[model samples]
Target: MARAAKKDAGNDTISLIPDDPNVPRPRLHKLIIKNFRAIGAQPVVIELDEIVVLVGPNNSGKSSILRAYDLVMKQGSNEGKLETEDFPNGIVDNAALPEIELQTIVFDKAPGDRWIGATEDGEMLIREKWTWSSPNVQPKRQGFDVQKGDWDDQVPWGAPAVANSRRPLPHRIEAFASPEIQASEISNLLMGILKDRIKTHKTGGEGQEKSDYDQLMESISNLQKNVVESTKAEIDVVEGQVSALLEKVFPKYRIKLDAKPEVDPEKTYTPFKASADLLMGPQDGYFSKVSQQGSGARRTLLWTALKFVSETKTPNDGGTRPHVLLLDEPEICLHPSAIREARTVLYDLPKTKTWQVMITTHSPVFIDLSRDNTTIVRVERAQDNAIHGVTLYRPNRSKLDDDDKRNLKALNVCDPYVNEFFFGGRVVIVEGDTEYTAFSLVRDLFPEKYRDLHVIRARGKGIIATIAKILNQFSSSYAILHDSDQPETDKGDKNPAWGMNSGILSAVNSASDSSAIRLVACIENFEAAMFEKAATSDKPYNALVRIRDDEALQTKVCGLLDALLDSNLPVPDGCIRWNALEQLEAGVAK
Candidate 1:
């Protein structure tokens, strides 16, 4: 596993180094795209992790990032050719040519030709440029010149040579979102596994097994030669006729039919050359081809095949290629239950140390903030009509202790909607159900003004700090509103609830330096501050009923809503620092 760190020169490039030298597996660290479709002239830098989940609305460039990665890493798929539409805004001029830079951490023990230019931390920077002054052009690799401090665009390497030099280069498997699954697709996946097995059949095997495998390959080649020789007499008849017809036309040239057999058994005897039909039926009944079933069944079959590959594929054991799985919307066509299972499979695929997973999803079920080595990036089209990606959550910046981690996990399990804020713009974190219900009603009153506003119910005071720390880690500006719990209990008391008030305020201050943070609290509790007395039970119900009947309370709640929703509105009796709460208590206690 690797960790992200800033360069000493303070550039925007993110450098990755392994946390432990013993765990040396090649992995992608970061990707930068410029002048690509959906992404404009301004570069969009995405920091990769073991499991990266990209979430956003439709056409927000999430799929573009995944496709760009596939285009660069995987060879012979369109052969790195770029169409006019691939350029930004469908313009294909020199300035609009697309370019992508990939930064990868390659361990010395990994099985590949280690390229020359590598940083001291063992990170390799490879640049891919589409040097097209016209349409349908090919891309080239630009190696970085450490001495010149620039890219050597004229690196004398073709795409195939570059791909071959890095033998067993991370085997990339793409499962882009699709409604229908063809039998050919399944055959291709199975053939990939079979091809890999055949390639490594003799590795670490007994001497007799290795000799048998070599003899098998040799026998296949001999059979091909024998077949060609057996067919030569029959082919000579056609060749004679063709040559005679050619002599009648020109009398100077002759034609011959040359039949050459493919000698490679891996190519001649793979699953791709045959028809693959998947049948599904009850144990005691007749089976039908899966193509006859609905899209859901086919999609489920595809997912099962992917899970199979992830589990049964060769592990990255210093002699095999590592795998990169670029999946787009694994949740598509899946039932809610199946989607959850898919999420787990995609997440756990990388744990085997053989595969790394990247996916674009619209489901919050795929986003988990508590997991290490997981990154959640929110991709969207900005107001300027360019795509922008913001990493809304990463584990390293959480600053969470063990207690916080336990509390965060408990919150994640208990609250099904805790991850919804990643899809919203401006967020408001409330302590419990009371403020969530009341402020939600207020937000509904003015929907357009607060279109992007999302109010998250933290469910308890203790979990507010954890949630706030996560929001702050991604530099998300948000407002925190909770009960001070002060007049009911002394602020200096040892009560944990009392302590969380200051704890929550401290989180706000830590985030306020980089992003806007506002804190507004009820003096004693929501019921007391709004209805003039604390509720014995049903606090949220009481607050909701009172606000509906009482006009004055609505006006006051609207004032608080302004502070929580609007960036310009100042919070009432807000404290930036934790200890400063006491001085502001007098103002809030009114």
Candidate 2:
């Protein structure tokens, strides 16, 4: 079994070398797209990270980046030829021919520079262009242009040898979309693995030991022959009936059925292929069709199967081609738990450096900020409105402190709700779990107003500033809520600015815009203030007891906040925090 490899220092490419110490994997370093759909005339250059993730809003060209890669690499056979609508704004008449250029670094053990003009960094450029004489043409003429050396001073478009060498790179591009895995796809994947294993077994050398292998192969051949024969016999019966019906109906014309075997028996007999169509349900029963299962189940099954096949080694003879896995929206139609499981698989997939995985997704469930090697590309419509521009966000050590880095790394892994901020329009950063709970209850009061606002726990007062700074980097508007911890002394009561000078509060205030980042400090702590306010009620003891009980806390908090908003009584001292919340909401509205 082939194990996943660790990243070599400074190397962004996967290790192409199998078990051999000398072989090097070909790595995709950069991609350049020009005049492609949703991409303008100015070339969009993207530097490939080890695990590249593209994320953005709808129609912002996130999928277009993946398609650009597919168009150039031809990952699958049915990528559909470049049509007129594929051009930007569906206008190809006045536009220049669309182009996709790829730069890769290949390390070959057997020496003779396979690259035309190899760069000092061992990078080579392969450019694919689509040209059509007229818009009416069904398929455009595709051309390959390869260049090596510096970006400037490159060769012309027709270099066959370099182009041929780069063809293997495309074979390495394997793209999988969500929930739509065809039967043929599963069959092909399984067949490829079985073929590689059989080849490996045969090359292990000769002896009586080979007899067992030969016998197994013979059994497989016999079974395949029987199946083919039975299939043909059935086809013959159907064809005969059709022909008889046609003769009776037309008298002059007869139907001829040419039912040749769709799959070659020699290539079709494999353990993997035999089990490709089989599906095990949640219970003991077997599902006849994968399509019958829920979308989440189907996606999980396909992803698991692909992961299994990817871990298998290629034939020693180098017959199997390497590929980069391109996945689009793996989180689609998945349950939360299933999405998390998918995230683990995706995160670990590219770690072995066996194959690179590039995914485009809108779901934050798929985003893991901890992994240093994962490259996040935010794609959005450019301000100029000509095309979409992509911004790369890689984990860097320079900008963040160790503690802040650890918090970010632990976010999705330990804190499941932090990712909600990514999907939200505004954020409310509260100091602890209690604050989070209270605010969440409060948010339910105005569902429409708070629909786009996400509440996140900062875990500690010290971390609130850090969380605010991090959110700022993503251009998020956030407000902070924390306990002032003010003492109940005469001097403290006299000073209205008691908690305003705290280090955490000062850090937050200085780091964020005064309007966008509002800070609310409870005079004595959230629970204390809530209790104080409930004390003013007619049944003070009962209200405090209701707030104390876990079951009643949520409802009581809602009732308390509602009462405060209605101005049914004098505002309680604890309810002063609501003013800060109002200001925050007003700023967010602006």
Candidate 3:
């Protein structure tokens, strides 16, 4: 509102005006990692263009990635339980058992930074994956490619090929946000806004009961004081070092000055009004005095710094590009408008030739605001205690795209399609329409999997097609059996017109369809109940049929269906017999 003040530019540190308006940029190609906690040894190749979102349940460690840059700044300091290190200083119970191995790349050679640029353009969000199986972490696996045709109709100029780069004070930036994004430079920016809005005084009772202003104001004051007081000497040392560095670049500005300790909260309690010579925008009027700003404005003003920084930072002198931007729970404590506003900041920042911003958010509202190329990494834990025991998910963006192809597509795909037609969802693949319909109808037959998945019908317009569609969306193991009808080929003709090149069969064999989608066959009955002997588990389903009362057919079938198929939550007993999966779904009693 204050004419969208250029976020970090007007701040104290970066006052050095640029000689040229446009700075050169570098390419951000890939990221390499290992023993980096739950990730163990994994190389996460990030495309320079796409804006990624890291997600997962608690303990899945999605936020850790953002924290790593800080550790890197510290040169691998001893830290205990990650969450603890989240507080002040190194963690108390911290250990140095296994240090994390991490590296990143920014691809500059390719031209287009716009992921969906014209086909003539060949650059987009590409994910290169690697793994560290042992404690001896190192990068060794190939990453899966995440690309788009780079269509001309979508991105005309052909996206700019962003180069690899890092901030001038990468250490300071890391140090600022290290241990937690909540503590980074962005946090400093927020704190500045907060100090500007704090109600320092008010009419009150004679005692410490406080006049509403006392408690909150005191907390902010105390924390600010602590930071300044505790770090006085350290601040001096840093300031001295910074002064030395400045000499290397700008030797002038002969004005030697002292850095005001950040804890000098009292100084900022009063607002800095615009001088008569400098005019104020409409919103700027709100900040004429710290007392004038409403408390509600804190969320908006504090969060807007991120948006400002994005628009302010000029590209570097043709150097390597910054590969990733790790943002953790940015929506916390923000109002609906502020959250919405924050989301806009995230999406818009990467719309330019900037680095990929990978954020971890628990807000469904935020999730609803993303595009197709935004990767969603969902984390899960294991039975044993392992540092890098986290599962990563790169949601299939096709489902959302397909949904946008038409209207009926919405009814078939589900509610998620209503908002997201590209990224962030799950797919349930089965055999045919009957199976699709049956499963769709009985989908809730298994409540555990129903609420958690975005089931879509595909290919044969049946269960098998749906199965293929699901495979396209998710990366974990999934399979589907087709009612092959034992159709024998017209062997007599060398080139039989059997049309093996079409329909569900072709999709099953297409080069693009990786092993993520497995195809099996069942002849005779539509139900896959014959290939039991040679098939896999036919767990809980049999148990469902074995356990359900005569009235709850839906429950029984749904239970068996979920247990036989796959699910997010644990399958209930009536759902199916976990071990009997192969027999029921694949049509095999054995």
Candidate 4:
């Protein structure tokens, strides 16, 4: 109160204000790969979101994309050496050189801003090219060039000397998998954590008063000094004799020993070089080496450790730089629940640490279709066997109707099998669980037809149209089977199946090409139709259950279905309409 009374009439006080909120941070914007591994001469441009998920069949170039990106952004060591097998088709003769280009956008001033010169469009371009000595020889990196240009600019330019300069960014890019989890890796991680903590405390001035760290450092110094002194004393005892012998052999020459421990406290004491062992086991039990741990346990530990390291800030003199994690098949060897947990961690990484995450996965457990920030890139080979670029699909909640959005959310929450749709080549959508079960049982009968086909349960006639729309968006070839549920003329308008039929018809009519889509309406419900054709009994569920659980029953059911399918007569009692079976067969034949 007394100080307030002394306020001057003409105030000259200045207020502490923060920087402009409009300032944008630097981030990796896109990646372009050309003629690299499975990728063809055409450049595949992939826009990077906070979290990028690459999903495709095996050998479809998903891993190649990750490896290419890793090659560009990797630092500290050159561990990725291009081999002969890395060439497309394992052939390099008369082939185009492999190229990888990275696009980075900066919105604000950064310490390493000088390392990257902005293009006319205000973006940085880093390009790497590789060439092989011959078709049979392995490919070697030709040059890494950085320039200022638009990301999509196809013009070629001469290499710049700046490409050989050191990277100014303070970040680390690492790949995590079962094979990368080793004792040395664990030790290095521990050392990084310890160094970060120590730096944090020292910077905050909280540990200055505590002499424990200082005392430890002093002890280390003394130990190093003692070792050097003892070694030098031992060397001195032999120095005279050795020098005399050397002088006698050569009068103008003399030899002397210099025994000194060339020790760098910081590097020599790092966890990687230091003799540090981690023993882990149950309490009150004899401990075992970490190497002896089970695969699952080791995986869990590695995951936990990575999660911690990724979230923690690495102490640096320069400002913190952005980090991007490249994970290839993180679901490998993990339990189903653990895979889901991993998904959660990946989803949270951007928010928690502002880090970018890229994952390649074949498991549905790793995908959450409802997430907004996540971008799913579908990588597939072209019909001509040429490497095709990835198709990026970002789930926009605004584009979906409220009802459709709710349905999608429910599917994510209740149906774990929904992800299989993304991985399958063709989809067979049926109404309810009974149809799904029956189709699954008969699927093996047509191995060629159903080799890459995935059967999904729509649970109701109302949802069949929704499923069809979703599948269509994925560019998936699909067949829909449902009951006609025809009612009396007076009540036909009120039948639920009628509405479903209309919806299905509407979707089909709106399609640009409907050749890939097939629809069949059963004359009656699934059970009624199956019971009418039952060879042994009228109980449809029992018959289907037997077919699913008993190999003998499955053989019998297959035989009956095949016989009925082969017959020319109208099979009104068949589980599936005769017309539907004919249409399915015709579609498969095509």
Please provide, for model 1 over 510-565, each residue's C-alpha lDDT reduced to its tens digit, 9 standing for 90 to 100.
77473467666776666666667777889788888888788888877777778766
Q: Which of the two, 1 or 2, has more TM-score? A: 1
Write the candidate numbers in order of decreasing lDDT.
1, 4, 2, 3
Report lDDT (Cα) of residue 419, candidate 1: 83
| Cα error, candidate 1, residue 8 (Å) | 36
TM-score of each: 0.77, 0.59, 0.43, 0.61
- On a 0 to 100 scale, what is the lDDT of residue 266 in model 1? 43
lDDT of 3 at 468: 44
lDDT of each: 0.67, 0.55, 0.40, 0.57
Off by over 4 Å in 2: 1-24, 41-46, 75-80, 108-181, 195-297, 309-321, 382-389, 397-410, 441-451, 461-473, 476-590
lDDT tens digits, residue span 191-271, model 4: 656754553345336446433444455567678778878678677768877888888888967667755443334434542
Using TM-score as the measure, which candidate wins? 1
Lowest summed lDDT window (length 10), candidate 1 = 8-17
Q: Among these predicted structures, which one has the highest lDDT? A: 1
Record all residue pairs in model 2 with backbone atoms less than 3 Å apart, i.e. clashing. 5-352, 16-25, 172-322, 172-323, 172-324
lDDT tens per residue, model 2, 195-264:
6566446544654344344456557756755776778867778878887888887886766565433222
